[model samples]
Target: MFSRAERKGLRLAGGLTLGFVLCFAGVAAAVLLGHAESGDGGPLLDPYLVRVARFTLWQAALSTLLSVALAIPVARALARQRRFFGRVWLLRLAVVPLGLPALVAALGIVEIWGRQGIVNDLLHLAGLDNPVSVYGLAGILIAHVFFNLPLAARLMLAALDRIAPEHWLTAANLGMRGPALFRLVEWPAIRRVAPGIAGLVFMLCATSFTIVLTLGGGPAATTIEVAIYQALRFDFDPPRAVLLAALQILMTAALLGLIALIGRPDEEGATAGRPIRRFDGRHRRLSDGAILFLFAAFTGAPLIATLTAGLSADLGRLALDPLLHRALATSLAIAFASASLCLLLALPVVMTPRLADRGGTDATTRFLARALPATGSLILLVPPIIIATGWFLILRHFGDTTRHAPAIVAIINALMALPFVVRVLEPAFRTHLARTGRLALSLGVTGANRLLRIDLPALRKPLAMAFAFAMALSLGDLGAIAIFGADGFVTLPWLLFSRMASYRTADAAGIALLLGFLCLLLTLPSASAEPETKGRGNA
Candidate 1:
């Protein structure tokens, strides 16, 4: 597909992707080997492990069910009410939670539903003696719903958007009413996408560490991922940690296999005709209005409470605190470093020659092109905590793990962000290359010159968007940081979590606000620059 220099670049890219995958696998293997050598020959299937596994399964299943069920009406209502006031903005707001830090959103959820929160306050005003507690299982479900519901809705909305206008027009012309229209047109679209969305949500909720740690309240609410963290950090039990990590990988692999069987919904592209006016939902205005209002309130209430709670906080003192300043700097540095690494690792894998490109018809080229991106995204199947645990165990054998924590955290964060970076950049890069490859080649533009002149200008926006996304993801991450954070390596999320754990509610709330603001600031550029991609599965 290219001159010798370009082929070399592609080879280097492939090598990088393989090296990353091997590093991850190597760490996990070392952990397992260490566990085997430890001779802690006790049964792995202890009662506690069993209980944690069961709880993890049920919570994830319940969260997925609730998120998907609720998303249906909200997505349908949004699709039907196409031109309502603030509709576009509402859709945009729905996606904000996707990028919102789990810890930030958890704080927001507590502010809304915690015993002393807004809901309880309203109940008290109404003379109701019983106050609600956003803790334990209820709290976990509420937080999961708050995050995943919007994600599910966005995906379903995108599915509805893909329904050709002619289908709607035909439904109207045939006088197909609510259930009939839904049955014939809407249901099929949703069904095609719902399985993938559900599977993704389930995987996310299953691997949840931050929300489970913060809102879990006690051991009864503990998940496998959190249990692994406890085993490694609190108990210093490498054997137990490795076992839990293995269990998580097994469960995730099984779920992925099941989801793969469902297959992905076909990507919807632009139609070459005028938009057809939707008429099936015209008479269901009142019901749709109520659904819209309920979802909007459900999604917005936590954010509102976060803002309100932080208003009374001593911002100046918090801002001036040296520890807070250090954490902020650490977070920014980590975010920048990880995002840069993610781009460096992702670009080559994405830029590799495809099966159909010139001089790329060989099966060897095709296999590598496909396999390389999969390798880049391989971290998605393995939780960040698992990687961190493996490296932590390996490093502890030789030296103080704290000294090496930041580097491990940075590498894991980069890998975690790699999947998203690849997803965002691969399509855009491929499209650009396909459109301009011949022109660039004819102009004798190859290798460094070609990338500098042709690819750079065309891909600048997407690259920026990918970087912003990668940065935001790393900034908000709690998983790798939870494992690697030490006295000198505290990031904002780690600091915020510490304050919350220590019962410094005011300080925690303040930190939460700051962290949320920073993440949102990073995410805005990506959100604004890129056309919204549908169904960012499990990213």
Candidate 2:
């Protein structure tokens, strides 16, 4: 339905986005391959690199196991106890970690598990002298579980929720309880989503930078991302950084390929809009309650600790700190720019398919349409640091890359948020077009006229929500910033990490609180809109 200029503009936008990604990939490959160090007739796997890779895989595997293993029972308990007081809020609480900045969550984990933390105080009160050391693999796993368990639980619960109410009713009629009920009814649903969830959790843990960076303590606990960061910034080893980046990309690609091969969850029967009162687990009320209580405490304590610790800091001093002010301003500017860029690029990438449909038999449009979304999401596989490092290598030849930090950081952050933007907008665009395309076409409305009056109105909410989500993701991101951040170009996360690095615990706490609040503020608009979206769906 678009005019020539509108269609051209869409093509131009998609072309530029695709071009940028191709350029990044091309330059990165050239630089990294140019520097690939194969040691004298041997493979490039140095002992140190091997150790780091092994540790990375080991930690990720353990984190995935613990998070998914714990999530199963917690999800089951929450699924069964659907009518308890505050159950709705508790369900909501399970997802709170998804919004939490990694740095903020790490701080909270430290507060609850550090030697000087609440746990140690309780231990001391009990006449125990041994203190918990949350500074190694134990700390990394704890932080990952703290972040991923709720996510796993929420995903598993969604699968459980999809179980047709009739199945539950059938189980109740059959007098099925616990193991028998789970084996026959619930396991299928959980099993359907489990592999996908595990893969997702594994990918997250594997690529995790902020959590591992903070809790890794020293060399023994470093992951590939951390090692890459160290290689570039600390050791100034570009070759090693390139090698690590290549390894990370290959590992992620392999995992993604594996997950794809595993296939999607089989579709289940649809549920009516009726409440599901599960009766099979009635005898486990006390047990379920205990499980939920323990899980909640496990997940919720760090959040409470973060808030309390932040509150205990000198707010007035934090307000007056020049560094904090600069970081906040820098963060907001970068976040807004990143979010805007993400939406701008995402719009065309998502629209390409629809526009291509008009081309009918044209293979080029079809190819462009299919390839753009995957290309946009390709940023996820290649971590921002790798992109930043590649750009760093290219730009350092011209002049100071530090001068280009803001733009570089914003662009990478935008790209990092691209998948999410596409995820949010593609469906809305598709739905809107499916419902309105013919009417608009018949009314002789097309191009800018159709866009401003028709598409914009229908898409405003999703666009705004996408912007907010992208802004939140960029606001909390430390990956790009970690690579490009300089003294003059620090964002909130960068500044927070800097403080924590210099043993400024009090300053770090205050910054974490501020950063968390800003992220939460950006996220709330979308979070609050969920019910409204669901209401529309139900209607």
Instruction: Report how far residue 256 has shifted in candidate 2, in Å.
Output: 0.9
Task: Give the TM-score (vs. native) of candidate 2.
Answer: 0.94
**For candidate 1, lDDT tens digit of each residue in 1-539?**
36667776686677666777677767666776678578568896889999999999999999999999999999999888887787877777787787789999999898889988889999999999988878899999999999999889888887887777778887888999978889998998899888899988998898899999999999999999999899878998888888888888898888878887888677654555657478966788889999999999999988887877777789999988999999999889989999998899887777764533655355656777767877786776788888888888788787777787877787889888888888888888878877998788788888788888888999998899889888888999999989878787899999999999988989988998988888888776456321133434345
Per-candidate local distance difference test:
0.84, 0.85
Report the Cα lDDT for residue 68, model 1: 100
**Residue 53 C-alpha lDDT in model 2:** 92
Error of 1 at 125 (Å): 3.9
* Residue-by-residue lDDT tens digits, candidate 2, 1-539: 55566667777777887888778667866776676653133458979989999999999999999999999999899888777887767776776787789999999999999998989899999999998899999999999999899888877887887788888888888889878888999999999889988998998899999998999999999999999899888888888888899899999898889878878788888667566678856677899999999988998899898899899999899999898899999999999999998888898789877777756736666777888978988887888888888877777788878787788888888989888888888889998989998898878898888989999999999999889889999999999888777886788999989989998988899999998888887776465321220112210
How do all models score by TM-score? 0.95, 0.94
C-alpha RMSD values across all candidates: 2.3, 2.8
